[model samples]
Target: MTKEEREQIATCIREEIETLRETVARLEDSAKTVDLDQPIGRLSRMDSLTNQGISGKVLAESKRRLLGLERALANVDDEDFGHCEECGEPIPVRRLLIMPEASLCVDCAE
Candidate 1:
């Protein structure tokens, strides 16, 4: 990829990392607000627990994505940043735009 394209992808990845950090912070705050000891109906507690579980999973996924984005940003200037690691083919710019963290072409990923 061209230098401009690599820079663009790096910018996008940084933005995504920032957004995910905000989401993770919010999820952590919400989890902290959950009170199991407070007097509440059993069903309500169950619902709260269920929501907490879902939130935990979402937070985990966000963290994972953040790591990927950070890795992509770190490698943005690499000679083969926009190439498929498996086949050594150029990855489409469109795919890279859509998924700045991707390191493989569609065929290789599949």
Candidate 2:
């Protein structure tokens, strides 16, 4: 990748990391264990539990993506930063712009 492209990807990754951090924080609050003794209807309790489970899953995924973005940002200046780890080919700039954390080219990722 060109210097400009690498810088752009780094910037995009930073922005995404910030957004994901906020999302993860909100998810953490929503994913807390439901209080069974709250005296609500059984169905309502079930719904709360289900929402909590979904939030937990989303939180996990957001955290994973956050970590990936951090790693990509850390390595953005490396000589091989834009090269696909799986095939050792240059990854497309458009793909990197869309997913700055990607380590594999589209072909290898598929």
Candidate with the greatest TM-score versus the true structure: 2
Give per-model TM-scores.
Answer: 0.94, 0.94
Residue 38 local lDDT, model 1: 94
Q: For residues 21-86, what per-residue lDDT tens digits would candidate 1 score against the true structure? A: 999999999999998899999999999999999999999999998888898888888887888999
Candidate 2: clashing pairs of residues = none
C-alpha RMSD between model 2 and the true structure? 1.1
For 4-108, candidate 2 gives per-residue lDDT tens digits of: 888899899999999999999888876655777899999999999888888888899999999999999999999999899999999999999999999999999
Instruction: Give me the displacement of residue 97 in model 1, in angstroms.
Output: 1.3
| lDDT of the candidates, in the order given | 0.90, 0.91
TM-score attained by model 2: 0.94
